[model samples]
Target: MTALSPLDKLMPRGYVRQMLCFPSTSAEVSHTLKTGLARVLADVPYLLAGIITSEDRKHVSLSECYQTLEDLYSEQDISDAIDYVVIKQHHFPPSSFAGPGIIPTDTQPPFPNPTPVFRTKLSLVKGGLILCVAVHHCTTDITGFGALLKLWASHCRTGASAAAGFDPAWLNRKALLERPDTSNRPTPASIPELLHVKGPDELTKIAALASQPSDPTTGVFFFPQKTLQALKHAVNKHIASWGNGGWVSSSDILTALLWSAVLSAESDPMSDRKGSNTIGFPVNFRSRFNPPLPPDYLGTAFIMTTATASRDDLISLSFHAGSSNDDEPLDSASISKLADIASIIRASLHSIDEERVRNVLLYLDGASGDHPPITLGPRHDGVSIVSWADQNIYGLDWGDIVGTCDAVRLPKLMYKRYPIVLPRVPANPAGDEGLEVIVSFDRQVFDKFRQSWPMRRFSTLRYYS
Candidate 1:
């Protein structure tokens, strides 16, 4: 019966779906997970509660009524969910395989009937198993969802008696909505990131655009440890020359690289003239508070920030200029350009502090009447990036039965323009440690991007739909 925060209400209308793949599959393994999930739900009953929205649809609250375990968990055969050829083609299934067949629920929000806030499905393949968990976005962000998964895994490894000491305070969601002294809070319109908030009509249009079939050129890029080190070294080397004492992390540089490539691919030199393109990313504010929020607090505590740069500056690589071949090495000028882009991203991230976070909370708290959904970035020309690299998704262990997760996947129904940077794959016997990034774009744009200098020099095309 707890009310969700304003920011929670503003989250995109859908379930946050995550797929974990394992090499082993057995009826016993499925039974253990089902029992584990039930135990976790009994300990945290709110997860089994339904979402109840206000008549005006401006507010949402968790329902007091809870559903039974049978209503929330399911088990099915892999052949009923996906083709076996897909499993053979990939050691781990790609994002395309995520669907209602495996999830067994409508992913879109405003459920036609009351449904549990969380649902789990286990699909058994010939030689493996895929566990798909769908948590309503309004209930929690990905970080919170990860915490829940970890808890469930812990319960599976250790008996329920050993897991009984779990703290109840970690489930508190209302802590994020506490209103502090707001006399000095900044106005929503005054925030640079809020400037592009779209009207309801614009949001409707965006929804329409999303419903259209995605372009066939969606795929993933795998960047190995060696490639990532080379990229970080090159970018940091350029920054060190300036002597600003400022630097960017591998995540920052990777984001910048992807942003530049996406913009370059989408830009039409024939008609796209001088203009600025923006990149928007969500910043986790869990630790930015003065006393710092609890690490285990399961709630939505993130806000979006953006960085902008002119098209010419970002697309100055030799390939964009048509002066380089696919096999040509990245020159000093390209590295310098990437360094600048990464710096912009780093600065934007640094701008989100405790004060700004409080200001955003104040704005969301005060919002009333009919207004547009907040825009993460420009509706048409910008890119929105979400990074799961820090989530440690691959580290979740389901005891000796499930082993470690082989790979993680998301549904194609997610916004195509919004690329997700997945956690680095676990080190393989070959000793390769790397990241998998999923991206989608029009045929022409993707074709150009895959052949771009960065793609050729630093990554391998792993999967495409």
Candidate 2:
């Protein structure tokens, strides 16, 4: 049995859904998939394992287990005429598609899966096939999911023998979590204090945020290679004027830009004078560790870093000054100045150094694993940004058998009521390196947001029904 880490024990129950769009159905797809599944079992056997939770629910472990291959990889057909382009042109609503492999189906009982992780179906449609891969979040984070697909896709392309070299990371023994000898040093940056949540009230507020309903919508925005370079150049030029300069990444600028747009669209000038606003980005810990966790570490190694400012500070001056109404037109120039916002984002992310990460591990180790390791978007006041700008999720290919995967989607399953931005894998070819920023907001807020400058500036926008 492989014991779960303290960090892993505190994660909420859920799975990550990755939908791949393969243009036009092919007879060879199923055969390629079956061969790939066999390779996965032999190469990454942990995918077939089950979670064993202690009776008191205090600890968790992975036990060697397996289910029938037929049960793990089932195929189904969608009689409807929905094609691949339509699925791409519009938002892939979590509810529209149903099959044996799709998760959270209406008929499944609560906590229904006997296995901790399983890939069950190949959804065949009229003009295309959708490959759905679902992995329990507790077992891995977003990167781990990408790694699994890369490995499987390799096996699919080169045959199972090519997968023999793949090895999964054993997460529990990472040096990042080892208690440091500090006989006389100040407490490393306190995770509890840095996160700012201490009591039952804060927990309740955070929990309540996820339960609130929103007229949520999904969107994909593409930033070509040249446009992205120009954006970073403009932002950095603007920042240099302030005499406070540092290396800023594309993720920082995009996250700041989205946060600024949400604030501009959602904040009410008349009543938001004293409101506090925040943007929280989940930083993947795989690279942050001193020695760094294995590239294939399948566990929840992430921490949310947030930047906060008053609503008045973030909104345009004209709106905050004395706008007669809440819906008055905002200044495009003022709204576009996001260098300062980007700096805050960059700093917040930079703060998560060796000490801060260790503090988080230490804090979770000492606390009761009764609630989510961290709370985001509580009380409808903050936004969460999860970046996959650096991950190669867009390159998973099954050779010529399945056709090339046009798009890879990460659906937002939790915190539906709150706005969350998922930056998707950029579209193919090196020059077309861009982002698909998916944002969720209330219907009213979304309406205002769509009219804002950011949405207007998008080269293309497809609002999901």
Scored against the true structure, residue 145 in model 1 reaches a CA lDDT of: 82
Per TM-score, the best of the predicted structures is 1
lDDT tens per residue, model 1, 240-355: 99998988988888887777777667767575547777777888888887767776567787878888876677776525446545556566777778888889999988988887
Off by over 4 Å in 1: 54-56, 79-100, 108-110, 113-115, 161-165, 179-196, 200-208, 211-215, 318-329, 369-381, 412-415
Which model scores highest in lDDT? Answer: 1
Assess each prediction's global lDDT (C-alpha) against the native: 0.72, 0.60
Question: Candidate 2 lDDT, tens digit per residue, 1-465?
Answer: 445565665555556666776775777788898787888777656666766656765566666766556656777677375565676556454433534444423112255434456564677777787777777666777777777777777888888554434754534534446545533434444445445443687678768875776546544455454555666777676666667556577667666656656777777746646766776667776777767787777667777667776565566532334444444443334434456666777887787776766666666655656644453212335466676665575655667887567666645432243333333445454444566665656566766666555445532454443
How much is the lDDT of residue 58 in candidate 2? Answer: 51
TM-score of each: 0.89, 0.81
- Residue 416, candidate 2: Cα error in Å is 2.5
